[model samples]
Target: MAAYLKARIDLGTLEAGNKLPPTAALMKQFDLSDNAVYRGIALLKAEGYVHSQQGKGVFVSDRRRLIAGANRIKGITSPGESIHHKLSARVEAPDWVAADLGEGECVNRVRTVNRGDFILQASQSWVHLDVAEVVPEVDEPQACDPTWQAIYEQRSGNPVGVASKTVDARITSAADREALGLDADFAVLVMRSVYVTGDKVIGVGEGVYAPGHPLAIA
Candidate 1:
């Protein structure tokens, strides 16, 4: 489906904000089962290639933003640690989610922790309802041991092949302040990223880190 989506996207058949064919339509087109179609979109959603709504339909997300955002994950090293590149997965729905999921849409909280010290918080907002529904495990607590390898392998039944990251600076919004345990003094480093395979986008994520935890982008 990533190939199909990419082909369409590259050919201008699908542009940013364009709605993808419904699951039923895609099922018929690809001759796939319900589970296959659903998992494909879930993989796309996780990779930031698309966004799906409850009653509406699936659509293309800003892939440029996704591509640019992937640059931020360059250096995982913090002051005390060489590179604390641990992560944890969860399912959570939040109201204050951002607009990346095609305006007025929201996503669940996917809090990723790096080691036992630096904490990275993200509200994953592009998941479709169908994909979100199938995710059985939701709402993970603050994880002390963060690892994305096991979780990704289990969710998609494949190991991650490649990942791209983007890094930029952002203000601490009211929601960010509350969620990340930030005070008025701290600014956040916005890390946008996409994890990909040969023909699939496995994960698309945006993380905000507190001020003291400097993100080395060069």
Candidate 2:
């Protein structure tokens, strides 16, 4: 039963935000008992294929995917896609962040990337205080110009030569779940990136993408 439903979702017979038929209807169609039908739904939910809304129904989750290059120099944004960044104040780097950017040598800048009403990802960037001061806009919340590489080059005159990224699966945090409207217990893809020029780590960016949004190699 779960296999049948998964095939439907994969083929887009059932699309994102499309509610699944009621339990009785599914039970009738699949010749399943009430418990059997629910168990199948539970499996789909655990696999991030669907989400249940209180008083509404279970619906297919969005499978909108994005691609990130192996050596991506910029933040991932599709062409002409409007991304708004809510930049946070420069603060002392966290332990993990300091480890990457060097303790006491880094300042933190955070942003929430959004496209229209949909929240795409939340990013926290760590850069040297001097670089942050030079860019200035890193501290200002505003719409990004397609990519961060462009902004950084224009502001700092330093082009990113190479970037390395690592992707992992993790449970969503309370704040990220609220910001991205993620379903309960859904896992998110965490991409940690390091932008470099020569041997210097110019910036470190960590982005959390909601479930159903897989990252492909660009």
Candidate 3:
């Protein structure tokens, strides 16, 4: 179905910047099952051929997918996409976070990447007290902007010195599934990162990306 649609798009049968046929319509026309139709559409999206806009349906796109490296994973946003973040206000640090950054009250950050109403990726991170002290932006109560590493450098004048990332596939947690709007407990690509600046370990974060997501590599 993806190949067929690509061919149609190539031939101008499905013009660029036009909405694709509705899922039901595509299912009928291609004689494919519902899952098959969605899978085909997902493939098109991963390849930068299309994007889903929640209630607006899928549309053909001529833009390239945003490419990110391991360091830029949490900041990946395609052209014209929106990002929503939630920052917990002065919460007790989680045990695991304390294990890494010592015992103290810390802030939790959840960043959701969206296109129209469709969610693309979800990243949840905890801020260390030192980082929060250096960068007050982390302490904002209603932070809705997905943050990149450079924010720290720009705000604190401390460059990101060394970084480490652990990438794996894991069963989706209930929280992540809800955030990503998945109907089932599918496996997701996960990346946990730690950033060190000078002699201080500034921050650590985890990013949850959909399998085969175009920007998942970062």
Candidate 4:
């Protein structure tokens, strides 16, 4: 039932901000009791498909429209976004980080991004030692205002040309669930990003986002 409703939203039959039929009408159409109808809506809500208002009923969420589809991701921070949490330091590269950036010490920046009060996703980035050395602020993180991508381009005499991204769907880790404030285990979208400037790759990043969260490829 939830999938049926989601299909409608995705196909634009329901459209964003469209109010759902009354609960009883939905129950009747689906041949479900009140509890079953509610359960369906609850599932949809978890997937960022719809939202309930105090007295206005359920409606499609605009967030789903701006989101990335097929699990593809981009770390383009929109205006008004902020860093919910961040930790930056120099550390030995993890195996995955080494695979992308090489087997050496790198500046690790771990951060959780927020849109308004909503937690968006958590990402861990590994930067080439040279970039961090030249841009000392790279080791001391700040707001998500200027994306790490933007920082990598600023005053380095080279402009970022392309960003490559790959994504995988996997089980959410306990630590990440805590970071995203999830109360239960759910599958998450794991995204890997490599940023390139001139002919050199400057950094690699991995981000974890909750299910139903909108994908950003901007």
Candidate with maximal lDDT: 4
* Tens digit of per-residue lDDT, candidate 2, span 26-117: 99999999999999999988766788999999998853322123212122343333444566566777788777666675655666656676
lDDT of each: 0.52, 0.66, 0.67, 0.72
User: Model 1, clash count?
Assistant: 14
lDDT tens digits by residue: candidate 4, 1-218: 77677756643456567999999999888899999999999988876778999988999875423344222123234456665447888999988778767888998888887877677788788888988755777778654323445555555766753356676888878888887888888899887877678767778888898677775332
Candidate number with the higher lDDT (3 or 4): 4
Evaluated against the true structure, the overall lDDT of model 3 is 0.67
Candidate 3 stretches greater than 4 Å from native: 1-75, 141-151, 154-156, 215-218
Ranking by lDDT: 4, 3, 2, 1
Clashes, model 2: 0
How many residue pairs clash (N, CA or C atoms closer than 3 angstroms) in each of the candidate models, in the order given?
A: 14, 0, 0, 2
Error of 1 at 215 (Å): 2.8
> Compared with the true structure, what per-residue lDDT tens digits does model 3 show for residues 1-218?
88777655533345447899898998899999999998999988876668878789898764312333332333234465666765556767677666665677777777787778777778777777777776676777444232434566666777673356666889998988888988888888877766677766666677787655653232
Candidate 3 shows a clash count of 0
TM-score (C-alpha, index-matched) for candidate 4: 0.56
